[model samples]
Target: MALEYSDNMPHDEDDASDASSDVTELDANDFPDHFSEREGRLFHSHGSLPYPLPVDSPEQARLNNLHRILRDIVELHYLGPVAEVLCDVRGRQKRVLDLCTGTGSWPMDMARLFPGVKIYGLDIVPIATRRPERHVQFEIHDVTRRSRWNDGAMDFVHARSIDLAVTDYPKLLQEAARLLRPGGLFFSGEIGRYVDFAHGFSSDPAHQAPRAQRFFQVVNHSLQLRHLAPIADKIPSFIQLSRQFTVPTIQTFHIPIGDWHPNTVMRRIGKMYLNALKDFAESLKPMLRETGMTQHDIDNYVNGFIHDIEHVRGLVGVYHTAWARKL
Candidate 1:
């Protein structure tokens, strides 16, 4: 079930915004006027001070690659391919809204694949560098606030990797439901946990000194300090209990962090995951320092952890994909 591009499809002129005009490139200075910098990381002025992640070029590149990796791993646009999942819907024009759309990779790909769908990508900053397709648009908007989209106006609402961006999961889900038409699809994908192992990554759980797990613990603590909740693992329960959505489904993928897997494809994915983890370590250093660790200690720990993971192998992390339809 492949999605065919509809070149003759009519465009939605009303939903287009001028936000992309200034987004020709991802220069730090080009970021919204409200964005502030601290320790070389960008933070939204409207958010709960000190956004957890960096919006710099390297981070944006990491996110763009990650979006591609996830799309390949999940192997679908929605619960199924766009054609199979949305075949029943009766409409010549479909609309999609990606909340907290980093780099706008997913929406841009969707626009190319499903040319009839009007794709809107919203984020706190305009980090997306790609020129918008005729049907795609990027906008600066915070996902936590009430959206300007009319009720039941969207056919599909997609959010991914927003665990750090969202403060209230339930409220966001509610907002997603409101924006979706009855029977419309809502897809949420997140990293449920930082790192895991089939048996356990640590050979000696108790005796092992502060290392990889400790690094994740400190990172989680830093996020907690910023009022961000680690709720990705619980999204399924949150959706099932909401009562506004039906047929909730969750698909979990365990990506190896290093080239430990025997299979060729798994090894390739493992290497990619390792590279991503390295980027994470760099991005997370300032935040980990906030957790009472000295700068010297933070450097030693992060370097040691990266070295261990690179050599040891078998470290894995869980990525969760949760989808449901509005009732």
Candidate 2:
């Protein structure tokens, strides 16, 4: 449930074709060299790329304190500690599949927290390293496919922000159910949609949040992928549909990307996100110039909204985390 893994990528055209292919047998040559790089700052492993993005980036490697804090919050809110979650398990060693393990943060943390567990992160890209204390493996496999994972084999199956890789929620859920051992846990955290600024936050003057909000709406509509929806709101219903698993306990919380209130943790996050957006706008200026907006217009639009949020607060995004045991 950390920010890094919770944010789903926009689905690309190539995703469908890639998902349809046999992922397990994919060769290293099929992907970029960096994706299959076996050595780095962290120890290397035979990890594969299961998704469409390059996993090895400076932005990914430099995880900040807030990321760790968010991870801890999700861990506490959902599964508690690894020992406590696994204590009820029937086995001495647990096999876990970290579905869509972006940057491998969750699996890495899991391995560090529970050395006895065998954790494997399956993604479109290799984002993790080998750990000495734990049998952690990173593989590039499209978990969206039906034949991807062994049925009833994993003690725990965890997926976060994997919606971009999966077009069908039911199929993904079914796959999760099938992969888990009897009575094993199925843990998921996802966002259904971005928050509507007008409903959630007051209008901002200096940082044209109003315009940015409108812009985001247009962008959201234009984008082919729409997994950013408020996924937490639907968890209860999704769990009810799973006959193989018991009703899942759901927890939803506002993860403010920047400081919304003057003194709130969200305000800081809001600023960071605002800056990130600004940086993104600058990067895309060349492509967006044809849209008729001047560079200043883009800057004002990006900065105005962020400044307004920092000063006025109120708008916040929701993240969901849930867990259910296989019956």
Candidate 3:
């Protein structure tokens, strides 16, 4: 049966033209395994979820409905530029690995763009894509586990938002360096703790704006207790660890909430961010219980997020993408 989609669904072109984005075209023999591209969507089976879930959830259901629409937005908005970095074909040879593949959008798009390079998508959970690109493969493996790749096996290792499941990021970096073939690159993109936006929302006294402040604080507090390094502060050190890796380059972007911008479309995009967060708050009921927080406390925390998302203007959250190559 053909998959049904909603009227509000976002498309791959809703954002920018990635094809026009800068790129270095390369040959197919750039990696060990060579696979060509096919037309129709690659992933089937699992529906897409509203947000990528951590492996701890152990929820393996296909997000076919949610993923088909949202994955494109994430790809264009978040992963596109980084994909370009990893897909660069000007070098000697390129073998790419995308960790925390989500719905496998990043790797799939990269493979489609560079049909010659071999790209691997790694995630703890399975993805829905079935694109017969011999150049790409999806593997179910934990990166936090000791890497199985021999020393210097890949040209690039990329991870995005995998910190939600990672307890020790620096250790993960050390592992990524070990897996990189000499002169390979290691890149990571991470969501900053929402609290960083607290100050930005404070200037505006919108209805839900104040609430976004508290909700993010609670989430940030919980994360800090878990010992995840603040995303911004750690990127530099992560790149500096080894003699083979060069200084990391960092790029930061904002995911604006509900169209606080002057433009109508931007307002709509902002609204979606707010809505996504509200829906996300509900899962906290069970999540809080696992954390040993009282239900009342969880309710207050989640409610704050909902109110701000709905009422705040010019409210935004940020994420960082940093990459470095081995010398």
Candidate 4:
């Protein structure tokens, strides 16, 4: 089934306002200041790449929403209604692990959808809310290190948007393979890179409005400096090279980065993406500064990027999902 979009649908401003207003302030007593000593923009306690983002209320809200948006895009375009196929294949008493599970929304939702499955969500920090679901558990663990789970303990090992967290992509895959039972599935989804805009306004890529090229250039540079894998573009090949898994299959989806699409669903998704990107760029300020990008220059780039996204059309980002079974 193809995903459909409608342009003439009614706008739900009330829902938008509710979502915007629902952000809860992080209580210091409850959340504890885990990042009190971090001087950089990225979280560094994990001894990995400095996670270039704050875990404050607003940032948490943005991440939660981005998680939902990405999940919707993947489910609609890639997995569709067949996410439960893994559950059926592995039987009802399934164990699932989600690495880099920011906000833990995906695993929680999966736990609800597959009530018989036990889902474990791991990340560098515990950002997931306490949910009533008994089968879903969230843990604070880094994916680059050895996991506490025993060998062949998982039925499905899932990862998403972990490009920034991993220093060794192949090693992480090896760990995942070790954790999965034979014939178990390993699935990953990631954005290949920043959005690529196709607009009629400019012929030069450098001169294009809402130019995000520089933003990503700084990001890539920082990741390279930190010796992190730029997994966005290299994820598929990494999966193919792993001897523990069968040949991987992939699905791709192009998400608009602005309200440029004629279809209402695409436009809505694009607008949400624009907001998410704005927050994402803001989070990169510290890393960009570390790269010696002046605050003035970064500000100019961010402003231009926002302008392009708001006024321009034809901007899109590619998201890819690759999956294979343990041999």
What TM-score, computed on C-alpha atoms, does each candidate reach?
0.85, 0.66, 0.68, 0.82
Candidate no. 3 TM-score: 0.68
Per-residue error for 308 in candidate 3, Å, reads: 0.7
- By summed lDDT, which 10 consecutive residues of candidate 1 come out lowest? 1-10
lDDT scores of the candidates, listed in order: 0.72, 0.53, 0.55, 0.68
Segments of candidate 1 deviating more than 4 angstroms: 1-34, 41-50, 84-92, 199-210
lDDT string, candidate 2, 1-327, tens digits: 111111132333212222221123224453443333322322123233122222335335432333454564453523623355455345345677788665677777667667766776775544444332335666555676753445666778887766445555667788888877777888777654454343445545224446546545533442333332324467657777868788788877665545544655555655655454444333334323434567786566656544544554466555677778888
The model with the greatest lDDT is: 1
Estimate the overall C-alpha local distance difference test score of candidate 2: 0.53
Q: Candidate 3's residue-wise lDDT over 156-183, tens digit each?
A: 7877767756767777788888877666
Question: What range of 10 consecutive residues in model 4 has the weakest lDDT sum?
Answer: 1-10
lDDT of 1 by residue, 5-57 (tens): 22222233343332222333434454445466778776555655446777777
Q: How many angstroms is residue 286 displaced in model 4 relative to the true structure, after the best TM-score fit?
A: 1.8
Top candidate (TM-score): 1
- Candidate 1 vs. truth: CA RMSD? 5.8
Predicted structure 4: lDDT: 0.68
Model 3 per-residue lDDT at 306: 70
